[model samples]
Target: MIYFVNILPQSNGDHVIHTENCAHLPNMRQRTILGYFKTSMEAIEVAKKNYAKCNGCRDCSEAIYNNYN
Candidate 1:
């Protein structure tokens, strides 16, 4: 499967990384592409370096957790 992720800049100087299809994703015009990854864990790792996990994106968080564990 082709997986993708994105990074959304926050007003607070933080960024949120979410799965491409995450329901919590901000509108397309509001987000930046972080690039695609082979696995969700890869995307999560990259996201963790620059942004916090979005609390509203349970699917993203759960995917990362499940992939890592």
Candidate 2:
């Protein structure tokens, strides 16, 4: 029932991706994605997109939950 906001880089560091809501998720818990971005915006975009995709995925919530755990 929580969310986290994360900034991850794309493999080439060209964009930054965001995650749930950082306030909800902690450092010890987070899904692992390979990305390298030059700025945080790009990462946020990716995370947002993933979140949208995860909305329909039953396993996605669990994945995020596990990472946050």
Per-residue lDDT tens digits for candidate 1, residues 1-69, read 223334554565444556677777667776656577766666656656655543223566466543332
lDDT of 1 at 24: 70
The deviation in Å at residue 44 for candidate 2 is: 0.5
What's model 1's TM-score? 0.48
For each candidate, the alpha-carbon lDDT, in order, equals 0.54, 0.35
Model 2 per-residue lDDT tens digits across residues 1-69? 223343332343322223343333325344545255543434444566644322211232333332321
Which segments of model 1 are wrong by more than 4 Å?
Answer: 1-16, 52-56, 65-69
- lDDT score of residue 37 within candidate 2: 52
Q: What is the lDDT of residue 15 in candidate 1?
A: 49
Task: Return the number of clashes found in candidate 1.
Answer: 0
The Cα error of candidate 1 at residue 11, in Å, is 12
- Candidate 2 at 48: error in angstroms? 0.9
